[model samples]
Target: MTLDGLPERGSWKGLRAENGKCQFLSWKNDFKPDGRFTITFFRDAQQTQPIQTEHGTWSAANGKNELRTDGVRMPDVYTYKLTDVDTVRYVSLASDPSGDCQEDYDFIERRIRG
Candidate 1:
């Protein structure tokens, strides 16, 4: 299973450019043909204690994308743009009325292996 060339089941490791934090991680996730996915991200040196884990589903439409997640403690819905097959981008204004919380999870993840 793959999503825009990303392996469905594998671990992606990288460093956060903003802070140079060692972002080691693992994930057991997959994407369906309907453009929906289930993912679990594990960060090695996460600043947020208890770590942050998210489970969400993303759907691609004409030029927009929507991500809805029913997380363990906090659930959120994020809408982003399907820029291309390799990138997905989303943003929310601080004053947005959505129940979603703001987080700084800025990083890039590349395929490693299962």
Candidate 2:
């Protein structure tokens, strides 16, 4: 299964500009077409603890060209463009020009598969 060409199961680690893991998201699907998904979060760089746990269903946002995760916390939505095989930038969706997109993001994650 894939969402906008993203594999259904891959551990995506959030990256800082320096390419450090400061957060994470791992998705799992049962290989069904129900569009159902399970998301896990790691908010710490060291990966010692979790600020948000797994419980959600992620799918493409209709006509918005973004990914939407239902049943999660703050970042329930994300607009992304893959920069490379390993990196994907989850661009911000704020409608105002005054909003900052670089200082922080939904969390840009690198696909975890060597």
Candidate 3:
């Protein structure tokens, strides 16, 4: 989709997978002047905390205007886009060596409290 078709930062709540995994994505400092601001999610419900990686952080250099989680990379990096201010999408760059362990994710942000 075009850049305008992406989601805005903070508009997203989190990412929930079909396996009952919930990931939290947040950004602060307007994409700069922040420390380890990450957009992370869980691999499954078993995870007590959000996942972390090198690419996942709160920075303007990551995505459009919103923060995205990785989608197709080895460790994956999430970034943001502004397809629509109200709608945010999470793109994951998950990867596997043998291609058999493939575990990737892509989702949109949904507001929980309007």
Candidate 4:
């Protein structure tokens, strides 16, 4: 299921411990074809308890195998692999020295469809 192109323009959702430690449960990312992206963090798996939202620009490089997100903080980079047409796994390339454990985990996101 390896894919070599930009991710589909839409919403993608995944459930994981916030910062790989907290009880917060879900992360939803919306990617637009125009390079704009938004990430919503939820405290529940159902995505009803949104805690925070971040906006940024995104780009794909390294033959479309890498995804970079530029936000208010630092630019985060990830190397991604497609698990299926509707699912992808992203490994963070940046390490967190604050011991957040975010880099210790892999994110698996499934495309959200209407």
Candidate 5:
């Protein structure tokens, strides 16, 4: 990862689905200054409406991108690494002994001016 890895402002998208289910998951992430960040989840590619939204803050933690979401349900900490200028690998720090939420997901981000 380089200084140009996580741009000051941009968007990232990724998809998640289980067991060939019709209901899939899409993540749309927006980055901004002042430690503000927003992650929106859409059920489909059209992205017409968001099924859930998480408001959070992002910053560097131990050379990794750390995100702390606000709310009781959301994970308190998430760690990410920018594999390159256009891709990001994200994983939640919270443990899932059942192997449900422990998988890593890579998001392909689109650079945007903000």
Candidate 6:
């Protein structure tokens, strides 16, 4: 059930591998149709221990092929590709100085239902 546009309103979860380690860096991103977003970082995969939370504004651009986020700490722009109805991959447009990983990796997020 792939949608023609971005999943504008939903909760998406993905594990971001940092410094080549992924087991400890997990996050959930909630997007709203009103262009607001909230990102919650967790110390564990189960998301029981939240480390930090950030708020930002997001929008689809370049004919819905790109995603741009504002007020977040990381890269602001990404080339988004939908893998499935509930899965999307975001490739950063710039390098993340805080990531410390040598290899570039795509951030894959899956939409979750409440």
Stretches of candidate 2 exceeding 4 Å from the true structure:
15-34, 61-75, 94-106
lDDT of 5 by residue, 39-66 (tens): 8888777677788887877776564566
Clashes of each: 0, 0, 26, 0, 0, 0
Q: Give candidate 3's error at residue 31 in angstroms.
A: 7.3
Q: Write one digit per residue (lDDT tens) for candidate 3, span 6-111.
A: 3223323544555534333332112223323344344444444545532334333446333333353344345555455455566655433532224456666654
Over the stretch 1-114, how does candidate 1's per-residue lDDT look in tens digits? 544333333343333343433344444344445645565554443523333455566554443334566543333333344344444344422222343324434433444433
Tens digit of per-residue lDDT, candidate 6, span 1-114:
123467777899998765554344788998877778888889887999999887767777652433334543665556787888888888766544554453455688998876
Residue-pair clashes, model 6 = 0
lDDT of 2 by residue, 1-114 (tens): 456655445566663343523223333222124545444444455555654444445455432223334532334445666677666666556322332232445555666665
Q: Which candidate gets the maximum TM-score versus the true structure?
A: 4
What C-alpha lDDT do the candidate models reach, one value each?
Answer: 0.42, 0.47, 0.41, 0.68, 0.61, 0.70
State how far residue 55 of model 5 sits from its true place (Å).
1.1
Q: State the lDDT of candidate 4 residue by residue for 31-110, as single tens digits.
A: 87777788888878888989888776777766333334443345666778777778888867764243234534567889
- Using TM-score as the yardstick, the better of models 2 and 3 is 2
lDDT of 1 at 103: 46
User: Rank by TM-score, descending?
Assistant: 4, 6, 5, 2, 1, 3
Task: Give me the displacement of residue 41 in model 2, in angstroms.
Answer: 3.7
lDDT sort, best first:
6, 4, 5, 2, 1, 3
The total number of steric clashes, by the backbone 3 Å criterion, in model 3 comes to: 26
Which candidate leads in lDDT? 6
